[model samples]
Target: MVVLVPVTSVNWREVTRVRAAEHQRRWVADVTYYLCLSAYDGLWRSCAVQDEDSATVGHVMWAVDPEDDSHWIGGLVIDAAHQGKGFGRATVLALMTLWEHEEPSLSGTPYAQAALSVAPDNRGALGLYRSLGFVETGELSDDEVVLRRGRPAQAPLRGSG
Candidate 1:
């Protein structure tokens, strides 16, 4: 089973070692760049994607957007050797579940949805996200297409007659 382990000083080195394949290098930044970002960006949190044996297989990070209270996932890089083994999907799903149940935010406001940005040409990632219910928002960040998966609709309360 894949688990998202919070990055700490003890494991930061292992997390930084996670890297992407040459072709995917264009889509995500180096793990160190993200680690440095989390250092200054208080809202951002980084995690190491570990496998059943607790060995790091990838890296992912997220931040709660203060403006819209959206959980924005960024800097996801699955080690080239670990790609195609479902670690990417598992990591994303685990984060989504965490957001849904934990509602991470600075203002205590619940996140309306989970969001991510992908390069227009990253067909593999686009496909994976779309299949997981993330739809394009017709927006772009750093020239990457933005996508979001919203919470499922809740049933309305019935009025007593």
Candidate 2:
């Protein structure tokens, strides 16, 4: 029963409390940084991942690329103590579930796919994303390998003139 609570001025304190394991810190930055991103970018949204008991288990954020009109999920961090409990998978699935229903403002259509990047060496995350259908796109972002899931974006229908 994992749930996502959008990070807000009222809940940022609780969201910031979620942290990754010491070693996993290299893969993700502090939650505060992600929250700051959301504050500065209207297109970016961050959320706190909570378990059935309502305890904060992790944090994740997503954004729609204005250039490509693609949905991108990033800044996923499961608290040090909450790892190996499937919260990571749940959070991602929860995000997909949300997007599956909403129309992107630019496209006026449901999100066709989602993209994310990962450090090539982060085996755990790579495994998680791969298991959930993300495939390598032979692309890189900030030196991280890019992967995407769902159907590729389709060209807009041209009015038959």
Candidate 3:
């Protein structure tokens, strides 16, 4: 019942309208996230979450940190009403698939890995990240607990010489 839609294909006003107690201001959330990441000159991509009825229910953001060949996933949010319906797990799997197999392009930037951070007190989030193989990096940004997930680039198979 949940799927990812390009942010461009949806209306920001509707996405952030707080149509129900479960909804929140996505536009403002993105704006705030961007401000904090202003120091990074990387490519940012956002996807909107759609419900069975195609209503905007949540949002996710990920980007490439070209400086380090590292990718980042953030802003993984779901509506309060939709909180325990497996949407969160689905959204995350969708993101991992996006980064691992899709090879998202941004002009000429290349990324070989990805990372994320979550609030330490958010046990659900911590468990989710760990279940997906993410581990604590002992790194903190502001009050967030940073975690990383990815593998070293694989060498190309050499022709049988």
- Per-candidate TM equals 0.91, 0.88, 0.72
What lDDT score is found at residue 128 in candidate 3? 86
Q: Compared with the true structure, what per-residue lDDT tens digits does model 1 show for residues 62-124?
A: 987877878899988999999899999999998877777776453376867889999999999
- Write model 2 residue lDDT over 21-133, tens digit each, in one string: 99999889999999989889677789899999988888999988777767899899999899988999999998887787556553354587799999999999999999998
Q: Considering every candidate listed, which one attains the maximal lDDT? A: 1
Better of 2 and 3 by lDDT: 2
Ranking by lDDT: 1, 2, 3
Model 3 spans > 4 angstroms off: 18-42, 104-111, 151-161
Give per-residue lDDT, candidate 1, residue 15. 90
Give the better candidate number (1 or 2) by TM-score. 1
Candidate 2: stretches off by over 4 Å:
105-109, 151-161
Clashes of each: 0, 0, 0
Candidate structures ordered by TM-score, highest first: 1, 2, 3
lDDT of 3 by residue, 1-95 (tens): 57777665335544454232223342125433532343253466667777789887776777766567677887777767777787778877777
lDDT of each: 0.88, 0.87, 0.66
- Candidate 3 lDDT trough over 10 residues, lowest sum: 18-27
